[model samples]
Target: MGIVIIGSLNMDMVVRTSRAPEAGETLFGQAFALSPGGKGANQAAAAARLGAEVTMIGRVGKDGFGRELLEVMRQEGVHTDYIGQSETQATGVASIVVDEEGENRIIVVPGANLEMGREDIAALEPVIRQAEMVVMQLETDLSMCEQAASMAHSHGIPVILNPAPARVLTDELLQHVAYLTPNETEAGILAGMAVNSIADAEQAARLLLQKGVENIIVTLGSKGALIVNHAGSRHIPGFPVQAVDTVAAGDSFNGALAYQLTSGKTLTEAVRFANAVGALAVGKQGAIPSLPQLAEVEQFLKESARP
Candidate 1:
């Protein structure tokens, strides 16, 4: 009803290490944990925590990880009634290594996620049409994103496209995106330039603008985010938080942004709320476990001064 997310669901295998090993040099890690993650699930849980009606559509393998993924979504109040189960592939999994500064490196093996095809999207045509907004990421098959975006756009539904696990995207696909949220590195790759600073981001945003995306939001991690559109560009500073584990922080931002936008907040206001959500996510651990509830966000906003 509020938003539909067509993305991936993976079980995160995380290890905490003092530092990542050099190429071919193995190092002992500090700790390890497993949790439900994947960009789609994180965003779905985020919006649900913020009181948005979230419907998630994707594919997971017919395995225990698949069942756990669904269970986590249901617990977060995300509607997973339409998700598919692939018989041949395994459930998607992400191998993550988080360092002391809360920075992380991730490698995703998109199992059943990559198995989703046109038939799956076609089956969810009604749900796509009914959504107030449709959100997607690059975790699954690019064609699936193309198909879903086109269908949502044709129905006049605004689509929020979060390009992550960065890669080059076609202009044909960008044209259907109402809002494009990409981090600095993703911006650089998509715009064919190196984004070394905020100025570089501005230049890249201009290039991305030409691709027909209505609005572009380039996240800057703790420094904040930059927004660009026909109206011009501006930077929104982020909150200062002592981050412990940064996994799923951006997903939190995207999820909160969608929730605030659907709740009638302006773009700037939505980004600000999302910044707070992201800030809260980093002060914890795991993926879904780190996403703060609505009450937590409210209290954090009241207690902590914005940066």
Candidate 2:
């Protein structure tokens, strides 16, 4: 079975700088690049490259960017048959700034990505049903995410919701998500608390569980991730690597986790794989360009494995 990703697709405009500018301040950039991105598209491409048959379902514009976006997915072997092109809006975009430390700041313009809704979901129902897992993010309309999650959960299929670009979530939405992957910042926002430590993340994860989330994984940057469920909590350490651009690390993690999970890896095993994927992603620049292929991930794991 394959993975179905229903979310946003965007062209990433990236600039490399020593540091981000402050309010009313200007700084010169060292370099600039453009690549295929968007949480949905990044995750889809990541999964596809890691050997998952991926079907991407979302809206793009009938513009040059849209065509380029579709072509990129095709090259990565992601199924674009269900992707819709909007006649009225331009394709989505993300303006990203990466500092010398590999930290990033991003501003996203949803554009046609916001066009996904119940109608698009209805049209893509068969694809969703056939998928072993459904992945989503907050870039598109929340209702669309909810609808997709609901539909997949109803069919007994697993739904993995990456609550990125954080926002308040409903209990109804949490109820349907089998796996809730939120970074520390997003987990903090959803849990109504400040997540500055692993303990804080565990508290937030507990809160999400109360909200009906079955399993919660709070990604902790360099500290790794905290996986929480009714069974208990365990801290999965991150893989260390030279940082380049962290833009796609989280997306890569989500995609790799979904791929591993759907392929029958246990939760802990899947997360370790995701951590490797994230570490590799940050070692390179650009978005989809940074995602590691299956062989790359396998080799990375082999080299990084402990004796």
Candidate 3:
């Protein structure tokens, strides 16, 4: 069975700068570019490139961006038959600013993503139930996320929730997540503490585990990721690389994890594979454009293992 992703799709407008402009201040940017992005779309494309059969369920506007978004997904081998078009809303958009260090700040205008409703989830029941895993993000309406989780849980399907652009999660939603992948900042919000280090991430993961999530993986950029569960915890060390753009690092990680886990790799092994995927992503630029294919990732791991 393949992976099912129910999330948002957006076009990203990125600007490169020395530093993020101070509030109410305008400054000249060094460069600008447009790319296909959105936590959901990025993850789906990443998994597809890594050889997973992927089906994406979401909404896009009835506009050029929407058309291009579907084209990109089709080109990447992600099934787009479930993606819907909205008549009244424009496609979602994210305005991103990346510093020379590859750090970024983003503002997402959800647009048509907000149009995804509970009805859509119900309609996609067969698709969700048959998948090996159901992946989702906070980019879409919380209600839709909750509905998708609930449906997946009812059918005994594993659910991977990447709480990006973090928001407070409710108990009902937490009940269904088989794996919760949150970055340090999002971990802080969910765990109600500052997650600045591996120790802090562990604390945050423990807190989330107590809240009913079966497992938690806290993504620490450059430093790596920490996975915690009933068995114990482990810090998967990151591969050092000079990052050109960090826009989709976490998405790449999440995508690779889902693919590996469903392909019979253990959780620890999957995370290690995911780290390699993330390392490759930051070394390049753009979102979907930066996702590495299976052969590329394998070659990267092979070369990195050299003495």
lDDT of each: 0.94, 0.93, 0.94
- Model 2 residue 14 CA deviation (Å) reads 0.4
Candidate 2: count the clashes: 0
Q: After superposition, how far is residue 160 of candidate 2 from its true place, in Å?
A: 0.4
lDDT of 1 by residue, 23-132 (tens): 99999999999899999999999999999999999999999999999998998999998888998999999999999999999999999999988878988899999999
Worst 10 residues of 1 by lDDT: 298-307
What digit string (tens of lDDT, one per residue) describes model 3 on residues 14-110? 9999999998999999999989999999999999999999999999999999999999999999999999999999999999999999989999999
- Using all chains and alpha carbons, the TM-scores for the candidates as numbered come to 0.98, 0.98, 0.98
Off by over 4 Å in 1: none
True-structure lDDT of candidate 2: 0.93
lDDT tens string, model 2, 1-307? 4899988899999999999999999999999988889999999999999999899998899999999999999999999988899989999999999999999999999999998888779777788888899999999999888988999999988999999999999999999999999999999999999998999999999999998989999998877788999999999999889899999999999999999999999999999999999999999999999999989999999998767
